[model samples]
Target: MENRAVLAAVLMAALLILYQVFFIPATAPPPPARAPEGVSKPVPPQEKTAPPPPAVLPAAKVLPRLPERTVSVDTPLYHAIVGSEGGRLLGWTLHYRGEKVLAERGQMGLSGLILERSGVGGQPVEFSITGGPVVLDGKAGEGTLVMTGEDAYGVRVRETATFRADQYAVDLSVRLENGRRVRQTLTVALPWIAPVKPGTDGAQWPSELVWQVDGTVHREPFDKATVAEETPGDWAGLDSLYYLTALIPKRPPTSPGLSLAVGKVGEDRVEVGLRGAVTLAAGEVWEARAQLYAGPKEYRQLRAHGLEGAINFGGFPLPRKYGGLPMEWLGVPVLLVMNFFYRFIGNYGVAIILLTVVTKVLFYPLTVKSMTSMKKMQTIQPQANALRAKHKSDPQRAQRETLELYRREGVNPLGGCLPMVIQVPIFYALYIALSVSVELQNAGFICFGRAPGWFPFVGGTDLWICDLAAPDPLYVLPILMGVTMFVQQKMQPTMGDPNQAKMMLIMPFVFTFMFLKLPSGLVLYWTVSNALQILQQRLMNRKPARVAGRGAKDVARV
Candidate 1:
């Protein structure tokens, strides 16, 4: 039986290796070829054509230009014409009330503002803003605005001239018939920080500016001398054009830096802010508009907005298909539960623990049955050993006797294995969930520190350490997991020869080492599960030594 287990494990491992090395790559489609320039085919000649003389006509009288009318309103509720050019959000104009934005042929930078594009073709993107008497500065005003399209690369502008002021932030509030009102406040509080050139003195400053997004009020001094390489993309693999740095001050200031980060909350949607600590004025609702990107990371957003790649955190080499699907599928449920737990427990670590407990409880029955079957196998080890020894030379006969013994004892040899096999999919699903879970990105877990740096391949500023998007280090966890696994195996009844038991010990180490570099959350799951299993085994059975002695005595009598 031990030999059989070793063979099964070896077969499974071979299959996995083959699947990863050959099958998966084979299934991926080849990349498209690039088109060559200046390649044109000759056109066919027309069959026939008629030549005609040209005639000149007198110029018609010029028509007078029509006067453009404008509308004004007292209420804040109004539609805005929004648009983007070359993937950059330009601006928006209040359709009925505000002044029109000049159709400029230059790039417009709405720095520090989150913007997302909508509408098709040259069609205007429209959104309603309610809740204002139109406050521009210290006064109230109103005007008509029209935002037009431009025909140039990287040139976008939304014309609105209600009362432009350099000092005051623009506030637009909108009310819906459903009684939900939204207020969008636009503030140009800070200058657009330029991207620190690589190998320059300023580059180090951006890298040294440590920002925390765990709803904590901590600050680190801005180091103009620190430099760090910029990651290429956002969380969704979109291009990152800017490198964001926290404006931490040495001394406590009256005001602190403000920014938002986006992460996936669930299956269908990404949560924009998980731990943003922004305050809203009384009667002033806060709203954020950002381009929700779902693609590969590049420097596009940073180049366009100068806001840096606030979304990208590195880890894991999850094949996009396998990685993205599981994350997207289980993101919502996991986040929802996590959020609920955090709200009540006030600790993200506790939330994860609770989440794990809940999950295990949900799968308790299967695990219980698996344990029971393992116990039965242990109980019948003596008979199994006897059968194996009786037909040692005849391997097929040995297997047949073993099967008959299992049937007679009402034991399923594969029963214990089946539940574990069933759990693979579930474990994989959770693995995907935790890997892409934005909630867990900067989240903390005791002294282990932030999720990123807590374990290998999880956290840290280094690309290798931060590569949450790749496979793990495969050294620590896998070995520990294998050790625990071997111990669990040792606690189980043995039916095979010395070779089989030796293989069992080796198998645990192999699996444990395989998991070392995986996400800490996945490791946490396995570790916790293993501990529980050990406890469960101890509680379920009496002295294994005594059982083994009884089995040996029975074998001797036979």
Candidate 2:
């Protein structure tokens, strides 16, 4: 029964395959068409469209240059004037520093520097700025003047001068905007143009260029404004001996191409800038911002702005490990003491005298030792002269013999000098401190008010000896200093060669000449020191001072 069912299933499968092959077609039959020839075809016309007109930028603008004008800036500390030309920092009258602006017009009364960019493609170098009559009115008011200018290519520049109330500093920023169609490389410069008087004029603040680069400070006279080569500096500006004008970068420039270029422009002008290729694409901005300090170099105030190094207390030659002659370190305390005394005495000049007295008193013992040693040398001078004559043909032998004679006579050749040598640093420090002390600016020991037109070196409203920071107009202090030095030299034992006495005499005249233009404060100190030494010499001569050896008693007191 199973074999029969399988046979029937096979037959049914065969029949199903036969039916499918017979009924269905392998491919679809062609459809019946109504029109199958070119007679029924139709062609459409072609059309070409032109592109939208190419974009054309407007020609670079040529704006009318406006007349330059001065904008007034008033703060608690100073009154400043900023000009529309290059947005230059024209001048500022210092109110707190107690100094009147005596400079003639266009003669950098103070800080005519820090704004100008390198121009290209016949672009005018100076920006024709247009802004406002800036008013920084009250004590707390942020005195800000933002002046803007643009060139023919639409390259705009902005200069901003901001003042903080009751401070001796002004914040300045220069920003460049590239509105050109092509990329632009901008070079910004802030230069000072002033007719600087040659040589040391005591009344004039000496002109110089100062810059800080790579943790080092550099200085150059006005004649040598720029460095030997371009360098990347943190700040650069022209500085007077006491007043400082700096353009300090607000931050380290990320671009390596930017460097500071400083150099004299023409015969009278010197300038500095954050100079380099500050490349800007079209519509991009490049900014060179800095803090401007235009005031007396007060230690504390300058330190506040990280400009204490600008004070320029003369550097002493020494290895890096041992700061040679701690001038600033010692000078600072010296200043502090002077100021401390000033607080009580209300007179810096009197404070200087007191400081001299204190120094003399402190070193009285050393002075006595020096005097006694000199006295001993004088007692043995005749024998020393005989020995020198005997050994005249042999110079080295003469020196040895002189030394042996000194040893036998209990005389120290360096004794008189060593004591004074020990005090040299103090004197030098005092000089440095006084030379740069702004507190002494317009400070007077004796005031005769304004001098007559006949006053030498200074005329017409010339303050006569009214400012200790300046040279004595009448030259009285210098002459007095010379006389005191002469008297002091005379009191010292004349034990050396006869030529030595002549040299000593010549020194007083030389010093007088040198001090003739030196600041009166330093001259006053030296004069007072000489006077004190002479007084000490007279007193010690009567006391029969002993030497440092066994026969000290036998050494006759001068």
Candidate 3:
């Protein structure tokens, strides 16, 4: 945000949607927050700043061009091709996910380091490859690919990428030696540079620039206007919905720099990197090491590396510290439970079902108590209304009698709502866990096939529920979920306004349409939850309610 006023406005807007009584209102969904905060140079509202300019471009080189070579490093975890030109990562394919991370043609492919003078417009140091085609044997367990080069500035550069057979992470270390007689300070940037047009926006597979500073992580929209923090932090990188590529510093740099940014590198090109400077006296070598994580956002896997923050579990949209609600605390536990269930069940779809069942059971006592209180209130409402009518001439007495009736009936007005209130955090966390857990990707539950040309826009093969992470192609789970929710709502005792009851009934359809495109795993969870609620309500109705006779007895007295 440009200033406190803007920040406050954003916070208020976020609060309008978050923490609402009903997640999906009878009204339309609230609009989105304008943007997430970026920790970078704060600019004046009237003054516009370009994304930090690309690292300085070197002056036209009169020297001959050094040949660029691509070296292949095949590990058990990943197959990668590295370009020698700038030590850029050319191609990376995760063995487990079987997804090839695409890289734009011109920009550094996310593993290259660029050296420039200590500010914008600083001349970038160019490297000429003077090394071999890096070699590594995955069967040997571990190895390193070293690409050595030297810049025109009296500096020698060594970029070594360490690979292990069993890990998704690759550690990169850059060793720089000042070959000059005098001391020199140069800005160092490791960029995940890509070609993105200005004002580009997307959500299906969003790419955000993330960085941590002073122990807090901030994710910024890849705005056309660059956002880069000058103060260096633990790490910076770019990530998409299911995949992550982050740079975590193994240790703080010995030499500090003038600026650090996760921003743009050039026109039509974007970058997210930790920028710093190293001042080295002649003949002195400075080295910096960072761990690069490039893999699926498996909660347990990333957590093991302390990089689990890369997963975007939707949080409370807010003007709060760290820019939003930190749902990870609760969400992580839910995710862990779901994964644990997966280990036992071997199918993520069933795992999600088990998770939902466990959650319902865990909160069963709270749910029963809430329902009981609502039933009690429903039972006594008519008598309370009669008392109010009797004392209508004296409004104070009417309220007073209503309170006494409530007390005698042993009904706590807030009981029905308070337990639900206590459960809200867990509910929100479960939603987030279902949404962001990557294990559900392509994890199947069931599949139904359609004959060729059976319906318009319908294909031949079995598509329904084939991928739990994707929407149900036939809209089965969402409709079932909605139906279950409506039935559950209808079965519950309504104690308040009739119009509110009707609105509550209408919520099912609204959510049905909303869930049409949501991941099937989430829809499955909702459906199961609603079904459980319905079953509980039916069982409660079957057994004579403890307060069922109270209403009739009180009405007779009246």
Per-residue lDDT of 193 in model 2: 41
lDDT tens per residue, model 1, 74-110: 2232222222221112332222112322111122122
Q: Please give me the total number of clashing residue pairs in predicted model 3.
A: 3
Any runs in candidate 2 off by more than 4 Å, and if so which? Answer: 1-59, 96-141, 148-151, 154-159, 174-184, 195-206, 224-230, 253-258, 266-268, 281-287, 315-336, 379-411, 436-438, 450-464, 494-514, 547-558
Error of 3 at 253 (Å): 8.2
The window of 10 residues in a row where model 3 has the poorest summed lDDT is: 34-43
Clashing pairs in 3: 51-226, 54-265, 257-277
For each of the candidates, the C-alpha root-mean-square deviation to the true structure, in angstroms, is 26.0, 17.5, 18.6
lDDT agreement with native, every candidate? 0.40, 0.68, 0.71
Give lDDT tens digits, candidate 2, residues 1-558.
999999999999999889867986643223223222111111122235344333233255656776767767766666667766666656667774464442223665333323223432233224443444555556676656776777555667777777787677777766666677565544454554445454333223447877888767777887655433457777676677777766566654443434665667566666555544455545556665567777677887887887877777775555223566436787888788888899999988899999989989988999888888888777676666776777789999989978877786667889989998987777778888889888898888876788668867556654546788999877889999999999998888874678878998899999999999899999999999999999999998787544424343332321
Question: Using lDDT as the measure, which candidate wins?
Answer: 3
Task: For candidate 2, report its TM-score.
Answer: 0.69
Instruction: Tell me the lDDT of candidate 1.
Output: 0.40
TM-score for each predicted model, relative to the true structure: 0.43, 0.69, 0.80
